[model samples]
Target chain A: MSIGKVGARKLMASFAIFLIATGFGMARYEIKDTPPNLSRFESTIASGGKTELSGIVVDEPDEREKNTRLIVETDNVKILVYAQHYPEFEYGDELSVSGKLKKPENFSGDFDWAGYLAKDDIYYEMLYPKINLVARGKGSWVKRQMFALKAKYLSALSKVIPEPYAAFMGGLTVGAKRAIGKNLLEDFRKTGIIHIVVLSGYNISLVADTVMRAVSFLPTVFATSLGVLGIILFAVMTGASATVVRASLMSLLVVLARTTGRVYEITWALFLTGFFMVLHNPKILRFDAGFQLSFLATFAIIFLAPRIEEKLHFIPKKFQFREIFSATLATQIFVLPLLLYKMGMFSVVSVPVNLLVLIFVPATMLFGFITGAVGMFSALLSVPLGWISFAFLRYELGVVETFAKLPFASFNVSNFPLWLTLAVYILYGFLIYKLNRRNTRKNQVA
Target chain B: MSQKRMAILLAGFIGGVLLRSFLNLGWAFAGFFVFYLSFR
Candidate 1:
């Protein structure tokens, strides 16, 4: 259904609010000062000289066989410090690193590595830093605890499952992709199922469902709230859930608007969400892809998923497969051009491979969670679940490998200009608006 | 869990993920909005 004319006034108000919020956020971002500590090192860092720097490990280390990459926030600057292999450091652990801090430079090819790092306000990097653990628990208390739980869960999962599979399960459940080798990782990207590795909603639901089930013995309200909290953490880990919360809340409002026959309320809600989010972090409106996508995808699901689902009515709605399929299709339709512009590779097999893998995602994730949770208590009790998870993992890998190996499975496109990407989206947004207006007219006729 | 609860939960989960995927798509479109406005 199109946007109801009755909500037109509210929509206008929301649009005005969004614009004001956006302007304010952009201004705030521009005027924002660099961290006090970082400002001290600005000249030293800019000189491109080798020097020692100390900072708190603001995030979990990306553990690769070659090196562990740590996002360290010094007094002021955020730097990517690479150490020799895993450095036995966790999040919130402060470290004194003796290494040359070099400014990020752009890659020779189409990829803008420097710009990417800059997106998160990181301008410097260190390779093979000499790291000394200065102190424990120097960052957020909540994040420290989350990382600890994550580490424990990961260790438990690894103990029960074998290598490669264990690493894959870690990626599937908690976005621990450092253990996943480059070749296999490429296979996942080629098959376009790499999203599963990240802490996407699917992964969250898997963990949340398990958490809910395990705590089912508890009071109903408590269990449900706990499950919701699990889902929220999934967003937080990605560093994009702040936007997700805004999107979710706004969409809920829009849904409410429809039910109450106050379509304007949805538009008003959208603007207000945008305004508030921009007010909180203006850079998100301009820089964060996750934030942008959350809004678009939410809109599509709210408007388009139902239409697509009806078209696919032949497919049994059993197990919610139809909904999954439709949702995937709808999101792809909206994101394909952008994905192409960013990833610079088009996987022709993305849809089918995603469908094949996504159906098994929840199952695989569920089994993986059960294995991890049960393993925490007893390896003997968790063995059966581990085996089941392994089975799902094997099947998923088979699908990904098979599709990735197909002749011309993906196209490596380069030099796709940003202007073109923008044009495509402008057209897309216009199309959505036109479609909404047309549907409004149709409803009026009927 | 009963079949009904199972179905509902699965649907909700899938729906959540779909919303996520769409947001990702919208993100891709941000470039368009900025450029379009500039040119216009």
Candidate 2:
């Protein structure tokens, strides 16, 4: 009646497969069932007149250069409002908004603006809305406090660091709501280093590594506990958005694996995390590009980076250059096809630009955190650290700007087929299989 | 299962999801059926 090890393994694998299959099935069913009903809004929007609605701001105000985007919810429907930056809004402010309510429209490119918003159940938008704050503090107490703390952190960063650099530092440390300017954002896109600015798993992983090393003098259990606590605090500090939560969970698994010396177990944990995320929000599997890229980049870092490092004999190991190089290469390779398909832009100089910038990221983040923390208390005391952080930020911006201006820096691939993207990934899977088989055979011989 | 089979299985599951995303539900079901047959 007892099952052998192979039998047990098979049973576990079968269970995993069943669970994943169910998840996929559920996602497909949800997508098929829940089409957005815009009939109610459409009738009002088609009137071509100003509509007045009162609602509570449901999410953080997305601060851009000239305007701030807010999601206002009343009853069951949520509307995206673009309000002037002068009268800034907080997360939980109740407001009466008057504007021309219109359905989200697609831009010139292949971007499906409506479909993208549909993932979040947002169908209508108010452009340049006349918003009056009716009340404040309508959201969860914890979120309001988190947003206030984030605002104070950004204000502290600005006291010491100049514009653009201050904004960039804010992005690196706290996922600041402020924009880093459209031109600079385009440069980041062209150079393919945009992930650095966003609160991605890569950034969280770096933070986790820094925490682990900082507390390495302590016992393994204590250090791991501290590292996890730091990650949780970080997630909470950043408003615990879905993206940050996912990154924190992935980083947490990685820290646990390193501390427990259980690398294989971490792989299952990683997959389970992904499975649960998809199960919770089936729309993200198809609609959310950030979700897709986060998982793919993490997977490449975990599995492909080491294999790539073995072949990168020419790269020096000093300063962890080889490790960074392998990681950058693996992630770029793994995510490229999807990126090309989703955003028809491809950066030819992404590798060189990444190498030039990534080496300073860890140090920049360290000094940047110090600058903000100290600046909060005394701006004068933080100036020295702020200057050091600014130098790194300036260099990174210079590299991105210089490389982005090159004639062959990037190219546009219009209408990339989905089948081709799938084909590329399948080829990748085949190559990985061959590589794993060869490694196993070599181990047997050894 | 062998590593190759495992990779194929994983790819098949992903392919089902991708097909469901890009195409219709029917294609996704068909994609899963093909992989199920192959695995068998």
Candidate 3:
């Protein structure tokens, strides 16, 4: 599709996402009824101490206001079992608890499971055991193994890099923690390079292509299948967080479209991904800021990047790196308003910071992966591997540190209304579309 | 460039600037607007 069309679509889709998200937020504010569902359950010796109940887990640790609670159904469900255990249970786990539910007490923070579960109009009841039983699904075993393997590789790769540089390398490779260190991240934030740190379509696709290339000896169909499986495994390993999942899905879709010799529609593909993810967990629409930001930023790239590229086509391809840089800058332009609307802070240095960091990011990731795999086979080689990896990361850190030190690297804007953010995006879309049209006609006349 | 394409381009430029102006992105939009018009 033409760049202008993509830009227009991006403008519309983001607007839609914003509206739906607002609707969910509004629902949370107004819906108030029923006392907290406090299920208390105890089993007779005949039934055994095990109890099973169904519940929804809204597992957002940060947004305590949106804590998860289960509505379980049971015939003799009046019993409330005090689930005396850590509240860090994964979201969406169904349980058959053989425990007792207790009355409401002076508990601080959000609703106690006993009370909250009861209020959900759930059919089952349980005040779970303090020494409780938790079983992650056997169905999730394959995904779990993939995540373990991916994380293992990431951690191993970090060992090869120097103290602080290892963290940044890990972030680039496997979307590992904020290990790139706070100060470096601050630099990236300032230069608008934070997207490089965040798992994005470029990172995922590069890795996917690398894996596919290695398996090229296999039949085309077989190799494609393996690549898709690898992508899925990588997504699972990355915690299948909304952003990671979305990027992985897009990468996989792009590959699938290309392999089948068909034109791909990135916007529709992205829209479908968002729709499916939200359908699976409607609460994510309200509760997950990462989910919103990931989709928005990516949508901007797919829609706006091309239009910007075409408008500036006067630049020679030999200097084509400028196109990549401009595309990055343009996406960030649309992304910043939404970022500021949600994050309350925008990094002024992020654009330059990202440009510098991205130049090294792909190379560093490749080296990190090779060293990680090598270490798995031979610890003896780890030192050299570690040395090489560290060298790449060291330079990366130096650049980040320098940019972060610049004045006005970060600033905050509070209470920017959603309407204003949306309007900015719409205008950006119109501008890109206009530029592309002009450029296309100029080329035609030439 | 055809007049139609240039018109679209100018429309986008003007619309973007007006919106940015309306929303108060500060002086950055002025330089951008001038640059865009000069290109046309």
Best by lDDT: 2
The segments of candidate 2 whose C-alpha lies over 4 angstroms from its true place after superposition are A1-24, A27-50, A212-229, A239-243, A255-264, B1-20, B23-40
The candidate with the higher lDDT, 1 or 3, is 1
Residue-wise C-alpha lDDT for candidate 3, range A1-446, written one tens digit per residue: 99999998866655444333433423332232222433243233234535444332322111112332333334423333334334544333444454534344536432233333333233233443433334444235565466557656766765666566666666677775434555556666765666656666567778887877887789889988998988888776665666787778777887788789888887668876766565444334434556667776677677667766666766566534666676677667867887887666888777777776676777888888888888767767887877877888887777877877878878878777878988987887788678767877988999
Error of 2 at A315 (Å): 1.8
* Model 2 chain A lDDT-worst window of ten: A24-33
Q: State the displacement of the C-alpha of residue A194, model 2, in Å, after optimal TM-score superposition.
A: 1.5
Candidate 2: tens digits of C-alpha lDDT, residues A238-292: 7665667777887788787787787646556666676667656656778888888
lDDT of 1 by residue, A268-350 (tens): 46556665665555445545565666556556665666667868968888878899889888776776776787677777887
> In CAPRI terms, where does candidate 2 land?
acceptable
Candidate 3 Cα deviation (angstroms), residue A27: 12
Question: What CA RMSD would candidate 1 show?
Answer: 9.0
Model 2 deviation from native, Cα RMSD in Å: 4.3
lDDT of model 2, residue A394: 92
TM-score of chain A of each: 0.83, 0.88, 0.68
> What lDDT is reached at residue A342 by model 3?
68
Q: Higher DockQ: candidate 1 or 2?
A: 2
Question: How high is the CA lDDT of each candidate model?
Answer: 0.68, 0.81, 0.60
Native contacts, share recovered per candidate: 0.00, 0.10, 0.00
TM-score of chain B of 2: 0.58
